[model samples]
Target: MAQVGHESHGLTKLEEGFRYTKGISQIPVKSAMREGAQALESARLEALRGRPEALADLMYGGRMGNDEPGDGYKYRGRGYMQLTGKDNYRSAGEALGLDLVHHPDLAAKPENAARIATWYWQHNVSQNAREDVTKATRAVNGGTNGLADRESRNERWLQTLTPELMEQLAAGRIGRAVEPPAPATPARTAPNAAADGVLKAGEKGPAIETLQKSLHALGYTDGKDRALNPDGHFGASTKEAVQAFQRAHGLKDDGVAGPKTLDALKKAEQTPLLSNPAHPDHAMFKQAVGGLEKLGPQAGFKNHAELERAAATLTFEAKVGGLERIDHVALSTNGTGLFAVQGNLNDPGHHRAHVNKQQAGEQPLEQSTFQLQQDTQQRQKLEAQANPNQTQPPPTRAMG
Candidate 1:
């Protein structure tokens, strides 16, 4: 609350303003310009005095992912924490499942401002702040721009939020507590008020049934991995499933199926399933394959065929032999083999490539004799490169 109050000036200034006088502009411009973060000539700075848009563009363009023209002004500081720049907005939007890139002003909306502020603090400052106001201020402002003011606010807030005050507020003895208003009632109940079609708990109908079905199809289950029943009842299990789905897809886990969450769920449902006729558990295998394909060239696979091969190997190992589940797969830098890292997001294993070597004259995955030989040679080369001194035994195969 202190940090937010300091950043947004008591929640009155959600969006940043740039109507600075020539001399006033120089203060922030010069401070932010240190180390060539922003390059503006003295004449140019003086000329940009009262032009908010022009000043914002000059100061913020070409940095912080503001590649497009007018992006600086469009993505200027907003929200309680004054989230600035294209990248920051986009990131917060992804985390919250809000299209902040196109709808940048959403960050300044009273409903979203606090959420964005909290998200920013959690991701960027919480780890380092640790009861230190200066570190928190620097993390939020990129410098100690309001260190003294923030410290003062923190002290004042600490004094105001005593246990007695909290108890009174909780007991309704005091006036309304200082919190953002409850989200406009879900669209199902308040059609006229809701701009976004939102489905919150206690709203049960076809819309919620559809949402539950989508969540079930996408493999989001309750705490015990029990699939959600498409009973059209927005019960606790359904809400938990929705929240789990949101968490996995980098969306805000508010358990309300809003427009953004609905869209992401639809996209996840529509992802193409991989087809490998030879694999047993073809349905599960295809889903795993689809995930790998979605990872795409970014994970270093050169083409679909390579991804298919790696997926086939991992799926086969998981289903037929030694692995629990196909969790992580990565292609080697030189594209020689796949590195399968076992474990889920919570408990990741070591970062080591475990290659399964085929016995001499043995054929796997219907690979031709020549292809098998080539694979053998590549594996040998990789092993040699990995250990030039032969100090340790050759790399062993571990199923992910």
Candidate 2:
């Protein structure tokens, strides 16, 4: 039942309480009586479920229940967190065993709030904390903060969720932190780098390989799988690292996690603690993905998550002469520049588009950065799709 309710609860904030970028599962204070206390409790890493303070807060914070159906600070931080005013108090309470009108502070107790949160996590939010939180927040707050309005609380609890929360309390940080699983055997690939694109023999994509290599170099590697492969495809191990990185940096657990994801992963390699993972790449990745999202509105998204939806689901199709064309999907992580090919625009297999591909003499890493900058190409392609009748302008600027 708790799991069912959690799935229905919606998204959360990634960076404090700003916007709902995704709709992952969230553990919130369901009873209005717990809202006030839940709000504070949720923001305190020290009182999470496994911690000793959790039960203690339930006793003290749970006592002050209110009367109004939705009155216990519904607007300020109501709903699940007892955020503010009347509506949230009533709604959250109605969902839980308590009635907000009778016991508004149901949301105030850390234990009750944690109980609801745990229920949510066990059922819905836990499926994919990163993505669900991001999606739900988008549904709630819109794009103002790109996170649901509960990131502060989420981040706080997330800090305590280190490997130690799994019922295994170690004496030091190394024991408590969520380290990558040890190798089932020996690591075959040596470490490489993202900036250099120097992956080991088994790797594939430039970006994937780069990330893997960088992760390994930065100590985010398994004792095994040291074999470097550079396919650039984000795989399982990468996903785990990303989750750890998000928690450390306060990002939602969306596995498609990118630059901010990378920065946090890198930092864990460096500092290894609960530090603010919000970085410049986070903003840049947001910008780049934002551009992808725009393509949907101008070009149209089929049924996928729309850019307007905040998940940046961009539905696009490359058609030629009324026949649908299968344009290859390439992320900046796919390689460093545009996939360039010198073919006639009028060629039957292809069309005239700016080509930004292979060049010699430049380091591969520089090329990757150059490629990522080409996200503009996607925006332009979207524009072309939206208004195909617009006359193609001739190149007028001088070459750099």
Best by lDDT: 1
Q: What is the lDDT of residue 43 in candidate 1?
A: 26
Candidate 2 runs further than 4 Å off: 1-75, 78-85, 118-133, 139-400
CA error at residue 231 for candidate 2, angstroms: 30
Task: Give me the displacement of residue 127 in model 1, in angstroms.
Answer: 4.0
Report the C-alpha lDDT of model 1 over 21-120, residue by residue, as the tens digit: 2233334544335434334443243333334665676778778899999897899999999999999998999999999999999999989998998899
* Alpha-carbon runs more than 4 Å astray in model 1: 22-26, 29-50, 128-130, 166-400
Q: TM per model?
A: 0.39, 0.22
Question: Poorest 10 consecutive residues of model 1 by lDDT?
Answer: 357-366
**How many angstroms is residue 73 displaced in model 2 relative to the true structure, after the best TM-score fit?**
4.1
